[model samples]
Target: MVYIAGEEMTHYATELFVDQWIKPYFDISTWETYDLSCKSRDVTDDKVLHDAVEAGARIGAIFKEPTITPSTVQVKEMGLSKAFGSPNGAMRKGWNGITISRDTIHIKGIELGYKNQVLFERHAVGGEYGAGYNEVGAGTLLTTYLPDDNSPPFVVDKRDLTDDNNVVVVYHNPYDNVKELAHIFFGRCLEHKVTPYIVTKKTVFKWQEGFWSTMKEIFEKDYKDTFLKEGLLERSGNELTHLISDAATMQLIRWTDGGFGMAAHNYDGDMLTDQIAQVHRSPGFITSNLVGKSDDGSLIKEFEASHGTVSDLWNDHLAGKETSLNPLGLVEAMIGAMQHAAMLDVEKHPDDASKLEVKMKVLNFTETLREAMHNTFRYGQGTRDMSGPSGFSTEDFIGKVAWRLNR
Candidate 1:
């Protein structure tokens, strides 16, 4: 893993992983870290941030911290002091929002389908689940799977539903690529015959609000029947509403109870996703899929771990101590990514029997990883570090995971 340290604190993370977790598996000589201090960023003329983004696009995995600086804070504090400054705040916003626009269709026994068929299927599945916290509140295990010849007949069709019984609500953040995310999300709703609705404060931020408006227009023009037929358009005495941010948050709690599919903006998504993940009791158990852009349409693409860098626990590793830093998130990310990759490969070459083998291997790996973590905790076999009452070191935790994966 290549890390760009955005803060002095983040440097410890690189040190902990390189020295303890990764070095034991792979040689550390090839690994490197880049310091991206505010001064260094200024010296490089913001090119560093752009370079980091491009690198992430290329490598498909990059961890970043929130960029903070005295000047940035000063500008925010001064607010209207800069009479000649740009209308937006001086603190540069990172492009943390993912741009997802393409759609992919996975039919259980069908092959050689057109892009239109796939897209129609995706859009039909729209808004099957409520947004963020509401998503978990609605149910657990949101997945779409198909049967393969290599898998047992029993396992293949276990979760398959004849009709679209699930609704998915997405909560996007302010910084996210709203237009692209909406397209992909809505496309999925349509594919699954679910109703998708977006909640935004576009009525106020008209100038900076092109994203949500564009999504609403697309849905209105392209998916009018699906939305209307689902009784989503005029619910509870109001026409299908596009609500303000705060209103949407309050409404989500009520809608979760009533069963409405919603899509939230970026910040709300971030905060609420965390809330839902915590409520699920296993943040590592949450599976996040990154739907990437495609010329054909939306794709059920990359998936990754949803947790953070674990800075607090990494501190213990720096002092040559152990910590119980969970590796379940990383393990799940790798497994999910591998499964998605295998599915894409299988779609491209249906004759490839090896793809099914690889997919099964990846699934088994996920189960094994989970079992290892569970067994290690159950047996108290991992080392202990006295940072807190738990007294588990970061290395000890990662070591436990590595042992499980290798076993």
Candidate 2:
């Protein structure tokens, strides 16, 4: 397992969680660690970020803390070399990430929202997130496609600008990785017995047709038969379905009992998941996992809390005040990383009795930790975010979880 440490209140909370909750039953001292805090990234000129991604792919699983992507003002505040971009884009590109999965977390006795499981898969690369743009003044703009395969370069688009100041943006979607994303998304849905939904704005953005078409093609070839046989999409008459982005949003709100999995392109996914997170109480009540493949075709999974560092809580902590910072998302992420590592070990040494024992032990630990965290909420003893004015502080919340685990 690879542990990528970050900055702020979440980091402090994470360390406390691991020390109190994890170290008791499991030994994490052997785990590889990388400090990805702003200072560390600046000191290494962001090389540490790439190195951490490489380590995650090699190690098979990574648990990451939320880190800062310094802005121009933040660069001056932190005295950094330059305003570095988000490490997420680089990590996703580096790991050949296909999809990011965010599922709603539920406690046994508590029902905040979403009566059923809602699994969302977002295509983790390309779209507006990777677009390149430049300001232009009344001039002919030519967009060209230069093939590296010795083919002649051709003009993709040519526009005559009429406005004084305009912007030209260039971006592309790759058809190659869409198949991998579909397989992952559909496979998980099938595994969990949920209806799979493909969402896109293909009608408006014709360019997005490629994504929907590829997903449909792959579903027909690989998953449609099983989906029909299992009657998973019985509500849609045992047929796969595609929802326009707008309709998908409407359905997400209307269908509060979420027994479905939806996959969308990068931008749509980003927005939709935010909605899903809110519907499920908060981002902390969501589980985030990025599924990818390395160059060797081996799968690499990275887990992290969907929320950012709790800057407000950290400030309070610095002022020597108690804070009720919730670490549910971070704890769940750690459980995912540990479980993935254990599964990888079993896969590598399937016949080894010792390996099987280790896998079982890890699995038991994860299951127990999950129950303990949820039980904390079930007993009305979580952090203030979830448990209101009478809630425990951050330390007290974790300490309560630890006590539950031990008892």
Q: Which has the greatest lDDT?
A: 2
Model 1 C-alpha lDDT versus the unseen true structure: 0.44
lDDT, candidates in the order shown: 0.44, 0.89
lDDT of 2 at 213: 85
TM-score of each: 0.47, 0.96
Q: Would you give me the overall lDDT of model 2?
A: 0.89
The superposed Cα distance between candidate 2 and the true structure at residue 91, in angstroms, equals 0.8
Off by over 4 Å in 1: 1-180, 187-197, 208-213, 217-241, 251-262, 267-290, 294-304, 320-322, 347-356, 367-407
Q: How high is the lDDT of residue 256 in model 1? A: 31
Best by TM-score: 2
- The per-residue C-alpha lDDT of model 2 at residue 391 equals 89
